[model samples]
Target: MNEGDDDISVDKNEDSAVLASPEVLETSFFINKPSKKKLKKGVFNRTWLNWVEYKSFLKEYNHDSSQAACIVCNQQFSVYYCSKAEIDNHIKTKKHQHHMKSYDVNQQLIT
Candidate 1:
């Protein structure tokens, strides 16, 4: 075989040896353009002032450091991490009956 013919064959093989399929090559699977809705307008959001009407407790305790304190039991806590509902769980505990009695006595004096 002639050396020139071998070179031509090697060039043909190189052209045919595309590692990626046409689907992979034609479209970029990397960059994602932002949608018109997301880019065009600011999202409607409740400000802190607006939120205060509902999450008043969050404002009272300064948001991040806030703990939900049980009004009856005086237990200050991060409510999300707490295993059980405060008032319900407290009612099941032995001390709850004593607290109820004390609370009744206090209410009587106020009346």
Candidate 2:
């Protein structure tokens, strides 16, 4: 067996992702081609609304979008990449608590 053969021991197949050589892999001169760049699309899931902690004020701002709205604070939050972390952080903020108290007071006055 040739010593160079060990470099490409992978089984050859039509659908194999292993490139034949480094030159073949570097055929494209462009550093960042649109086809190479991945676009991450986020979607606001309805199931997040069912969480006991978030159900009270968390809601979907748009159908199948990457955004959630806080009912108590009257604010919209992006849930891209990290969905629950963004939502839970917003709920834990002092501003949200203040808004919650104000909303409750306003509701009490109405009742």
lDDT of 1 by residue, 1-111 (tens): 766564544564467665888777656553454445533222212342255322322122234333444344554544344323432454566665676578668878999
Candidate number with greatest TM-score: 2
As a whole number from 0 to 100, the lDDT of residue 42 in candidate 2 is 59
State which candidate has the highest lDDT: 2
Per-residue lDDT of model 2, residues 1-111, tens digit only: 776665655465555665567765576545455556675755677887787878878889874478899999989988887777888889789999999888879888999
In order, the Cα lDDT scores of the candidates are 0.45, 0.80
TM-scores of all candidate predictions against the true structure: 0.34, 0.55
